[model samples]
Target chain A: MKRRLLLVSNSTLHGGGYLDHCQQHISSFFGKNVKRVLFVPYALHDRDGYTKTARDKFKSLGYDVDGIHEVADPVEAVRKAEGIFIGGGNTFRLLKSLYDNNVVTEIRKRVMEDGVPYMGSSAGTNVATISISTTNDMPIVFPPTFSAIGLIPFNINPHYLDSDPNSRHMGETREQRITQYHEEPNTPCVLGLREGSMLLVEGKKATLLGTTKARLFTSGKPSVEYDPGSDLSFLLTDPMRS
Target chain B: MKRRLLLVSNSTLHGGGYLDHCQQHISSFFGKNVKRVLFVPYALHDRDGYTKTARDKFKSLGYDVDGIHEVADPVEAVRKAEGIFIGGGNTFRLLKSLYDNNVVTEIRKRVMEDGVPYMGSSAGTNVATISISTTNDMPIVFPPTFSAIGLIPFNINPHYLDSDPNSRHMGETREQRITQYHEEPNTPCVLGLREGSMLLVEGKKATLLGTTKARLFTSGKPSVEYDPGSDLSFLLTDPMRS
Candidate 1:
């Protein structure tokens, strides 16, 4: 089976309704076959509220959204899910819950082996990568490890912001942070997905989607930019796996 | 022996030279008796370059500085040092080196038990606290643990920035990130130190230093603001310790 994934940088854009900016992409990705999406609201503290917002938005798009939290057995739910969607919030909390629920393996299998459609926004998108090391969220809690779902071979830095020459903040810029990640030996490439941008992957092909361009950082190489509709299938090639 | 510490929010403020804004506090914190300081430049990748910057600045303040990396044994370097200073870079990288060099326990003892004056800027200030959960830096690398030296009872969010109301970025503001941190049970209070602000600790008493106000966030309570010279001794009282 081939993998199908839509990884979004954010759930809501400034002045936009939840998932409003990416409605068209979300619709096209799921197509008419996926009737429902199993929502993982663990990233957020208010699971019920998160689910309601996701449920309402997906409903308008003609799909029922079932929160994995609402189910009795989460692992079984992942195994039986028609489609899987993880919402945005704190990345640390999201990864912790993913481990605590013991569905990491099941979800990986569902998406990798069974070809269930997977959708993730922000923290959700972060977990779909090899590791959450590139996430911008605070490490409020400790998970057993930083290793994530690995649905994709590389890491995704959602809401990637470029340095403002006018700003005087002393903290590391998004690019600098990703550069630091590349310092680690054998680390994978990192994609900096700006707001309103996302990656659409099907089988062995991956493409940049949405309005903005994405920055790609690979070890020992100059960072490059990819515009909308550019082929990003090279990102799916995991040297370790290949 | 009294515990002495100077935790700074940043090494260089906007339009200011390195440590130029906080020279008086650093001078007073070290006093005339401490003529030399041991520097930890592990947070940054370029140890020599970071050390040179720190060395020049401390020299201008009338102190001889030696990089810990220059010494044969980092543990011994921490033991006989008149004052210990850890410069700012990446928090994860800093904490990892602290553990990797086998000096966390030694440095903690040098400050907590031996009363050797200790100073930290940015990333350095973060590790002096209970954990690095509230840091503003990216987790570029995985440390063995989120735990730090814990010279103080709570966590410090250095280079903390207030939300710009005019900005349209959908990412969570600094305050929201700390709020998410309090959602975890038994988490310690977090202090958000704005740029140019710092904390001065002597024995059981802690005082907010520098020009800016600091925000303190305790779990299940509203955050409170503290001006310069405000008594923050209560923060030193750890519920777990006492």
Candidate 2:
């Protein structure tokens, strides 16, 4: 079976409701067969509130949302999940919870072997990548590792922002941070997914699906930009493995 | 011996030269006795370039700078150092090098026990605190632990920026990130040091230094602002230990 994923940059766009910008994409990605979504709300502090918001948004798209926290056995829930949706929050907290719940391997197995559909927004999209090294969120907690589910070979920097020319702040810009990521040995390519953008993957094919352009940074290479509908299947194959 | 530390928010101001905004503070903090300063340039990728910057800046202040990387033994370098300065770059890389070079404990001993004056800017200030959970830098690399030098009881969020009311970005504001850090169990208070601001510590007393005001966020407590002269010695005591 082919692995399917819809990795969203953010759950909400500026001046938009929750998942409003990507509602259509979500609907088509899950399709009619996936009746329920296993929502991982561990990234956030308030699981109930986050789950409710996700539930409402998924319900509007004709799908029921079941928060992974609500289940008696999280591993069993992931195994039985028709589809998986992870929302955005603190990346460290999300990855730590995924480890604490011992669901990282199970989720990977379900998505890779069982062909369960996987959907992630913001922090969710971060964990879907090979690692969360490119996330914009603060490291409020230390996870057991920086590794993630590896649904995609490359890392996604969700909500990637451009440097404001007028800003006087001396902190490293978003681009600078991603460039620094490449300084490490054996680092993977980083996709800077701008707000209102996402990547849709079916089998070995991946496409940029949104209104804005995404930036790609690879080691020893100049960063490039990609527009909506651009082919990104090349990112699916791990360069290290190849 | 008194634990002396100068934690700066950033190395440069909006329109100033490197360490230009806080030169006087650096001079007075080091005093006339500390003639040679050991500089830790591990936070940045270009060790030589970063060391040159630090050497020039400290020279202007009537002190000689020695890059820790230049020495054969980093731990020995830390032990014999008259003064220590860690410049800012990526926090993850900085902490990882500190552990990899086996200098975290040595630097801690040099400053906390031997009364060696410790100065850190940006990522440097981050490592002086309890943890790097509140840092704004990306996790380009994973360190063995999030634990840092416990020179201060609380954490410092250097280069802290206020949320722009006019901006459309949906990312978490600096305040929100620090608040999220408090959500973690046994977390320490966080001091958000804006650009051109720093924290100066001597013995049990810590004072807010530099031009701008600093914001303090304690768990379950309302956030408060502190001016340049405000007494922040209370933060020297670890509530977890008490």
Candidate 3:
């Protein structure tokens, strides 16, 4: 599949407006033929408000945007969409809404077979991987299964943060948590996609973008950090990636 | 049920040894009749090593500790145990192991109905509540269900931390994540048990212990912070607690 994806780590930077850092990247990814973007507001608590916000953002990019929920047939809207975008919120709730509407397979098929350019941030980026198992969000809702769109080989842990050794708190750090994951049988390779970073994929090539260094974790191997613009395409084709 | 419980928010302080801060408190909780503690080390990745460390600490406290895994029958061990201790690790893996071995109901029955003293730290503390949904750990493993021991009325968010408002990070803070939980339908009351804090439950009362303030969150109510030694027992009998 000639798939194109922009798996964003977060929607906004520390002090930037929503999608401000991503507007140019998104426009460049979609190109001229993309006159409309189908927005999945399922992750949001207030769907209407979220949709309206995303709609305005995309509209500023000179495209008409519609929330899949606003339409009677979400699957049909997905089928006819020029581009698709899934916003971030609670991953569990997002996956549950997808399963409840029976749209996971439809969205997966479209992004994989139809080769419709797809973009996701936070919870959205979580669903783009094998499963949303590494998400940092609370389990506010129960999804039918942990299965998700395997658009890429390895799992992406968006908005990843390292442990603060100086902090008085004793909670497990992100790295420690991921180490526990590797201890489990048959754990997948995980990319600790720090905030402000995004993974751009086209065809079989995936590149890590943004200024921050990202951490790559695999079992029985030492985790390594990669600088910005590193070629991460190896993850897309590694059968024993885990 | 005449249950005695000590739900510790963490196993260690910032620069302390494992369970070092709570060793005396644990000894007091178990009393002289509890000669041995059945330790559930399932939450830990290195169960054997973790049990060894915990055993050393408990041994110093003048008690024999048995790792449940070393025993032939985990359920039977819980049944015959004078006191049960669940050490902290990953909540998801711990609950999954409990459900897999059919030990949740047995342990719950023993601690809640038979009056066997029980204690849990970190992920362990998270499970001694209505559900493990409020845990701050990664979703490294999926439990068969979110159903937990239900020893307490509300859920416990162990090692809870507040938002660093001055930080440049864009990820949701602990408070925001819990608020997202409340937005979901039928959310239970969540107690943000800060590090160094714990809940001591006896008979019909539960009291907050240690130096830090614990955050209380309930739907349609402003989240409030409770100082140390606060009586939080009313939550035990509130039918509409959520």
Candidate 4:
């Protein structure tokens, strides 16, 4: 079986203190009896505050909650870990730190080459792309333009939500960003993911796990709506073989 | 002096009417006695509606607007052409027509190889990249994945406006998009253009026009603000020497 890669999002999470979509699904990839969990608190406003709770959750799950730090030795942590879970926070901040520490290269090697069951929340998932050009963050921090370990070819625009009528600051909507991507190059297939939706890439199969329709955008093609949990082998590689 | 390249924008234009930016600037490029003008109306909303008006504009300048449907035929039109202008509308629509008709190759050859004096508004300006993945429109219309002619390497986010307090939509701002670009695969600078602002590329010099400052995003570097019209020869190759 292919190692599981999971992304948990803060964008869609309601209230506080509960896992959104794909939270429990992490167990499916790493067996129910998985041990040794490393939770990254880089995104937390109160990194220390979240660390205690994360440690408790892992202890309840019968795994060790190794350590919680604003900055950790990513290479050493991954090297000694069984399963890695990166929780949600500001993507720009998390990625900037990772790039700064030179842990990005090691993390890619761990997941793509070593088959580590890698799981991330909002920003964690955003980093799984060739580049994080699609994230909804201000370029307050700059990191290198390295491709994510060849786990995926295209970029991911995560935590996608349509425009809410009740809100007030005017700017480009999530739909508009995808449109901008389409207007500029329109080649890479941009998956506009809803809150409950999760994209599962196992081996060559890319399975969408969610309850609603996810939109796919490609260059020169009309934007199409797709039901989640459907196998998208046709979109990637050879569909006929799948 | 190197041949002039002009870009006209449709975004941020209030209730588009007669040409304000195009006419005066374009007239200056070729001089008062303009002899040859080729208008690419692929970006206009109503192709037929704007095509006639564009032709009239050229005729008013005492220059003939060559070929309508043959706008894609760059080889024939670009030869000995004194001026090339692309009108504004939906860049996606314009690019779709360009890609479907397979005119990108001929145009790239004319601009990159033949060094024709090129002028484009909105969509026409957007097509000068390797891909149109950074445009500011809905992906409703399909253009080629890499529709840009790659006259420049970085992505162009045109008609960029800061968030207006009155309207409410949640997403990354243009500054955030450049930030995200800097965060990952730190390559190709992101140029966030406002209305009336244009990028002028002549031979080896790429200068930001109109705007006083441009935000420069690079990997591992803090995004710095640079004055517009600064000599950007570093970003370009010396075409004369090459």
Candidate 5:
């Protein structure tokens, strides 16, 4: 139980401001003692700009946030951090940065072994899962691998949405795409984390934290929907209970 | 100008039948003389089932279509093919299969060198580009490479959509994603082909064939919208005229 993770579906809600709904959760999860937060800003095209935006937002929440890029050593930055926050823009870019910086192992060690509180949204949430396989982002760049930090057992389809049943477009719906993914036997379960939804994980317990219901897709099994505030900790277990 | 290719944005229109709008174009492009079409059904989970569906549809158009999977040697089939059709499902799967079967070279030879009439929709259209980097599909599985047949001079965003101007979704918009891609500077132009649109390429000349206005994104240049029936062959040229 040496892990603390607050994985949010998105940074902003529809018609809301930046990091609107996630601020309170982040503050509560980190508590007042955590001061210096190491921010992963690689998902965006402009690292400094993205970090500035995140920094300003976190500043308003009474926390000192530093971009991992601002530091000379990414691994050392994570080791010295009181908390970690990964801002989402592009999952491929973020995952590649983790590998390219050679800090994937360091961050894993810091979070899993050191129990540094971790928070992520959108692409951040995608990387906190078992793999980056379920992300909805374009494959703009090839990553070294699809592997990600296994902060949680299941994969996350952040900013998840249902297909517009009435649209004439032929693109596969989010549901269809994930369904095809489960076509391969033994694939892990996927959580369709809709906008405004999130998963709060502390040690062995995890909870769905939002108004929207999360859709769980399991191979060879009917997809189930869990309401907000529902116990989703079992999802953190291997071969999740039905 | 030995290559002839028909790239469609999608297989079916919303609330419409499968491949309905595309049958005429397919028939006209292939004509009655071209029999024995080699179909690539590797994108779908059920290759045989997808082949059967396509066969029925193409048969009604007076064409003899055979799935590449049915042949003993896929390369041999492509070599003898009068034309080629790649059905849509998943781009990652299709590209992986193309590499796994060692048919990527064969198909490129047949299409780029031998001048075989080629048709692809959705995931199929995705591989017709320089790379699969612009595809909107999930990264369900890793392909050996993001490299595709390079049938076209530039990349494609198949099933392209304009971001909803009225709403708030934290996920990057189709435009934002492609624009971010262009930020890399050396990235090639991206043609966003909306549903119901098709691009017709014969040798070095290419034409947009549907009603949708294809948005072309080039770095350091404003995106231009090309109306249906416009000559896009200029897009085939290197260092496109501003």
Candidate 6:
């Protein structure tokens, strides 16, 4: 069997303080001869903190951190690595860099075709969707299009959470965002991921890892929230064969 | 042969404002004997000022207004209606009502199957997408779950505007919101609809209606801007056949 992919929430050493517990869920994966970590530059301006923390974590478990490059070299890095970890950042910036450099195509090949372990946190995980139309960011600086590697069919809105009870932003809440997504392409599911949550995909299996609940939205239906750590692998694996 | 659908902007009379220009477009359709209008309560509140304006406008135009409660009922109202006009109000609220009443499924049947002329303004227009995830409203309350009728295959963030350059929101501008959406799903095209803008979809034809420019984003690529009133029906139409 091929190794699984690992996407981290943040490239920061301490996991952006929000996803502090995410590391624990994947510790078992790391323990299983999973070596080599790649830090996406679109999210990391300085890999010093993230690289060091990741190195320490891996080293303590007898694993090695393979490559940390400032340039976009996803294909080469993932091709040789046993596992991959994509940390989070401004998803727009990260995706822009990936698209600009054509790294998305390459990464797709490595993870989906070669069966390399592909892991992503935050923005990294978000790129798996067909269109990131539900993200709560300005569309001016970034393009208003969404495309993905197709490892998964649905789009993801990572770092998703319910509205802050005290937020005065005067905008729709997280649930509202997903509903709007359904209004467009009602079939593609929108995964609203909360902090410390990780969606583990293996072949056709997807497991939600973390404390917060994951919300699922389908077209014309009300959104439903599932408990943390649910077996959502059905979403990843194609049901067509069944 | 089936009559074509006519999507009007806001039904609310603007009292001769610039937005009132849409009336010319609406009248053009009526000139062809396209009668019977289904007023979408999905976006309008009975108590709202805009709703009153829309009612008055329809009456003045000599067209009968059928609320969601009247006509053949929501289903019959959709099927028997010669035209469908989704007026503007709070799009989120309207979407909520649609989801609550299960009217989205019916509207979809009418427009996609029955070929009812579907017209909308502002919030009404926003719901024409696969999902209404792009409206510019804050999700004040979470609907049972957020999803809208997907008359079109993409997401639309209506009421798009450049920052006032003077007003201070002190955060991401409208452009940024769409950009972030691209980073996540990176597939469905996100359209920024400014005031007076409309997208006329006839069979396989999608004509852009308005004066300002709209922006587009694709995965891994830089964002691009489009001038309004362009015949970019290809964006919404099926190029393979049309």
Give, for candidate 6 chain A, the lowest lDDT window spanning 10 residues: A9-18
Query: Which residue pairs in candidate 5 collide?
Result: A168-B14
In model 4 chain B, the worst 10-residue window by lDDT is B233-242
Looking at model 4, residue B107 earns an lDDT score of 70
Q: Of 1 and 6, which scores higher on DockQ?
A: 1
Error of 4 at A146 (Å): 21
Models ranked on lDDT:
2, 1, 3, 5, 4, 6
Model 6: per-residue Cα lDDT over A151-222, one tens digit each: 677766665657657542323456765664455423466677755556776666677766567777666656
Give i-RMS (Å) per prediction.
Answer: 1.0, 0.8, 0.9, 8.3, 1.2, 10.4
B1-242 per-residue lDDT for model 5 (tens digits): 69999999989977677889778899899987897788899998998889889999998988888889998999898899999999788898889889989998888888888899999998889898888988998888889889898898688888899887775566788999898777765788899998889999988889999768899888878999999999888878862344
Model 4: residues >4 Å from true position, as ranges? Answer: A1-242, B1-3, B8-23, B33-36, B43-46, B50-75, B87-100, B112-115, B130-133, B137-147, B153-155, B161-170, B183-186, B238-242
Q: Candidate 4, residues B1-242: lDDT per residue as tens digits?
A: 35356654442344444555446556765675557777777664456767788777767766777644655555566555666777656555677767776667767667767677777766677777545655654433444354477777666656655555553233445565555444444356556566666767776667776634555555455655657576666655522112
What is the model-wide C-alpha lDDT for candidate 5?
0.87
Alpha-carbon RMSD, candidate 5: 1.4
Worst 10 residues of 5 chain A by lDDT: A233-242
Give the range where candidate 5 chain B is weakest over 10 consecutive residues by summed lDDT. Answer: B233-242
**Worst ten in a row by lDDT for model 3 chain B:** B233-242
lDDT of 1 by residue, B96-124 (tens): 99999999999998899989999999999
lDDT of 4: 0.60
Stretches off by above 4 angstroms in model 3 are B239-242
Per-residue lDDT of B12-113 in model 2, one digit per residue for the tens? Answer: 999999999999999999999999999999999999999999999899899999999999999989989999999999999999999999999989888888
RMSD of each: 1.9, 1.5, 1.2, 9.0, 1.4, 11.7
* Per-candidate TM-score against the hidden true structure: 0.97, 0.98, 0.98, 0.52, 0.97, 0.50
Query: Which ten contiguous residues of candidate 2 chain A have the minimum total lDDT?
Result: A233-242
Cα displacement (Å) at residue B49, model 1: 1.5
Q: How many angstroms is residue B134 displaced in model 2 relative to the true structure, after the best TM-score fit?
A: 0.8
Worst 10 residues of 2 chain B by lDDT: B233-242
